[model samples]
Each structure stands twice: as structure tokens, then as C-alpha cells.
Target: MRNFQKEALILSVRNTGENNRIVSYLTKDEGILTSVLYGGPKSKLRSLVSPFNSGTIYLYNDEAKHSSKITDFDVKKYHLSFRESLFKTWAATLAVEVVISTKCAGSPEECFVMLNGFLDGLDLLDENQGQTGLIRFLWRYIGLLGVQPDTTNCQRCHKPFYSGNFSQNTLQYKTGGVIYSHSENGFVCTDCYKASFDNPERLLFSEITSKSVVYLQATSMCEPSVSRNMKLSDDEIASLKGFLYSHIESSVGTKIKTLHSGIGIL
Candidate 1:
């Protein structure tokens, strides 16, 4: 058995075996790890080991069984702001699941920074700006996983979504550049969306507007708090969320409970 301690974020937790709980953490040293938290629902650590909370965790690993148990968790922040509404809760849950699904695929430091920034930004965001804020966070998270769809050029038609300045503002709207297909495998230009219109094999394809392109470009490479938040209409939020969440589902190869649960709410 090996015992160790590290700074970690509580990504998720679930009750198990009546009293005990299973806790998932994004550790600064170990990336993403799941360990059993002994004791029942009434345990002292139960409250501390929660979604969106960051802290230091002490764990005991059993080498033969390849399993771990949490000895102690000292939380630094509870991130209670997101609990204010259903949408905010859904957005936070989405972030947690995305991080876990990707296994924090790059430098753990970079991934940790982006995740923290996103949660913080969401907490600070005004209610009116929730949609845009959520979009920015999701885009930033997707980029960290190294699977972000490139909107600058179409993978199928070999056409450029942008022109001179390499900015979303420079995208040529003419010749049908408004929409793009994010098939299960990869990206296809909006102009070519007709080619595979009836293929049921493709898991999902996003019809993103020029505004979405702009938003993606702006948030793709930066932390979530880079700029002031924007206000988007209900339809705009739904479309953007649908587009980004589909990319996540395709990449993770799993259903997203948080995204689907919202239904008409997200």
C-alpha cells in the first residue's frame, strides 16, 4: 500500500454500498482518479467531497487491487455560486464531466488552469450572460482536449471559413459558408452538408452560424475570463450548446447526462 497527498478538485461523487461513497478527483499530481471514500452518508468527509470543490486529498493506494481509498480531503473552495440555478448547475456539471471524460488529456497544469478559470467565470457571470459564458467555457474546454473542430478551413470541401485576417470576422459568408458539419468522425464544410444529409451513421453535425465561429475563435485559445460576457438569445444559446456538446459526446463516446437533462432548460 502507498499513501500520498496532492492538490485535487472534486469532479464527482456518488453513494455506494449504502453508506460509503465513490469520489472522482482531478488531482494536480495524478490527473483524474477515482477512489472509494469509506464511511456512510453521514461521514464527515461526505460534505467536503462534492462536485466543483477543490482541495488537498490524502489517498491510500492498494497496489495489488489497483484501487484507492480517500483518507482525508481538505477543501479550499466550495464554488456554491453555480448552485443558484438549474442552468448554472447544468453548465458546471457539463464542465466536470468533460474534464473527466478527456482524462485531462494535456499538461495537467494547463488543464487545471482552464477548468478552474471556467468554473470561476461561470460563477461570476451575470444571469443574463449565462449562455454566452457557458459557450465560452465549453469551447475552451474542448480546445484543451486537442479535438476542437477547425472552422478556419473546411475539412471536406477544402474551403476557407476565413479570408485575410485569420479572424472569424473575415469569414466569407458568400458561397454558403454559414453552416458546418461536425460529423462523428470530423468536420465538413457547411457548403458540403448536402453530400451526407441522409447518412444515419454520422452521430451529429452542427450548423453553426458566423457568430458561433466568432465566439469559438475568441474563446478557443484563451482562459474563460478573457473578456466581458455577451448576451445571446434563447435560440442562439441552444444552437451553440448543441454544437459544442455534440463534439463532446463524439469525443467522449458517451452520453452526456448534464446536457441532456436540461432539455428545454439549457
Candidate 2:
């Protein structure tokens, strides 16, 4: 009286009753799912249940039953280094948290594809790079969540932003979001920024350093290999990191534990 079949990405797992575990996964067709796995605690199966693994999972559900159970799973690829590097591991963990916490049940195919790409990106990291890879992963994850920051133009005046104009730049941490100057509502020209700041409530802008601007623009569009080739200045990296962290905190709406554990943030 039980039915079975599923291929899923293991998101998280925790030991439950003796030799049992509660496993969470996201399926290509069924979306996010939680299943109880009996005898998983001390068995070989436990190795397959770790985070960010892609596997074929065998599941069973009785026709008359309401809950499904995962009987077994075989890992297709175990991304070991992703689980090893402090930054890559935590970044992958954060990506998982975003997917599990924000994605709706039965999310679209795009979600799965994006998740796969994220894992692939993590696998490409090496020790020579700073947290750039992790930062890119987090940024793209934010895009997947549909809360990506507006990096295009002014939030209020709707003018295009150029790097040359602004002597000072600013961004609101809360709802108003990224702006070029204290005046312009969003990213704006220095002239427009000055004009807008003259009138309170027109726009609020934050001064972004030249190096910061270059790094942000470059990282967002550059290929992973290209990003690796590029070296960021200390001040530039710090500014970019602060910008990304602020956006993540504002958009994701939760503090990442991995970020706070001193395991990922570099």
C-alpha cells in the first residue's frame, strides 16, 4: 500500500529518533519536501543526507497515508570541498537557507536550475580568491528570490547613473534603498543628486567610492573566471561587501547564522 519515486537535492537533515532522521529536500517536480527516514542515523545512508547533495531518493507513501517517507537515497555527486572550505561551505549553506526559507512549495524549474548553478559555482572556488565567489553566490541567490537591488538608475528622478559624477554617494539601508546622493531617490548623476538633495524627501543617496563602483559593476556581470582574474583593492572589497551585506539583510529578512559564526564572512 505504499508508493515510491523521486530525485531530489538534499537540503538539510537532522537526527531524530534512534537510527532515524528528518530529511528535507527539493524535488524537480514536487518542490520542497520533508520526509522521515528510519534507520538513517548510523547507516551508510547518513552520508548521502548532507546539505547540497544531488541524489536519487527513494520515497514511499501509502495510498491512504498523509505523510511520505524517504527509505533510501544515493548521491549522484558529493561536492566535498563545498562542505570543506569555510567560506564556500557557509555560502552554500546560506544559499540553501534562502531557497528553503523563501521559495514557495512547488517553485518553478528556474529555481532548481538556479540552485544547480550555485552549487556549480561553489565547486569552482579555490584558495587564492577572497570571498568574491561567495559574494557572487549570495548576490545571485538574492536575484533568484526576486528581491534584487536596483542598480540601474535613480530611484526617484529616473536618470541614468554614471561613475564620474558623484564625489559622494549614499544608500538608504531600509525601504528607500540604494541612491547615488542624498537628494536623488536612487542611483543618480552628481548634478541631479545635488539638485535633489536640495529638497528633502526628493531622494536619499549614499556615496559609493570609485573602487567600490568598479568592483560592483564588474562582479555582477563578469564570468567566474574573469572575476577570479580581477583583484579587488582592500577598500573596494570592504565597500562592496558592506553594500551586499546590507542588501541581503534588508531583502532576505533574516540574519544568517553561518555569517555570524565566523565561518564564512571574510
TM-scores for all predictions: 0.77, 0.75
Task: Tell me the RMSD of model 2 versus the true structure.
Answer: 6.4
The superposed Cα distance between candidate 2 and the true structure at residue 42, in angstroms, equals: 3.1
Span of ten consecutive residues with least summed lDDT in model 2: 165-174
Best by lDDT: 1
155-212 per-residue lDDT for model 2 (tens digits): 5565534333222333222222234442222355455555656576553445565444
- Backbone clashes for every candidate come to 1, 10
Q: What is the C-alpha RMSD of each candidate to the true structure, in Å?
A: 4.0, 6.4
Write candidate 1's Cα lDDT for 1-266 as tens digits. Answer: 99989888888888888788888888665678889998866778877888898878999999999989999888888778777777778878888877777778655777787788777777777665767777777776777767777756567776765554432224343344345455434455655677676777444565656555655765764344342332345776678877777777877788878777778667
Where does candidate 1 stray beyond 4 Å? 61-67, 154-177, 183-205, 222-233
Poorest 10 consecutive residues by lDDT, candidate 1: 165-174
lDDT for each candidate structure: 0.71, 0.63
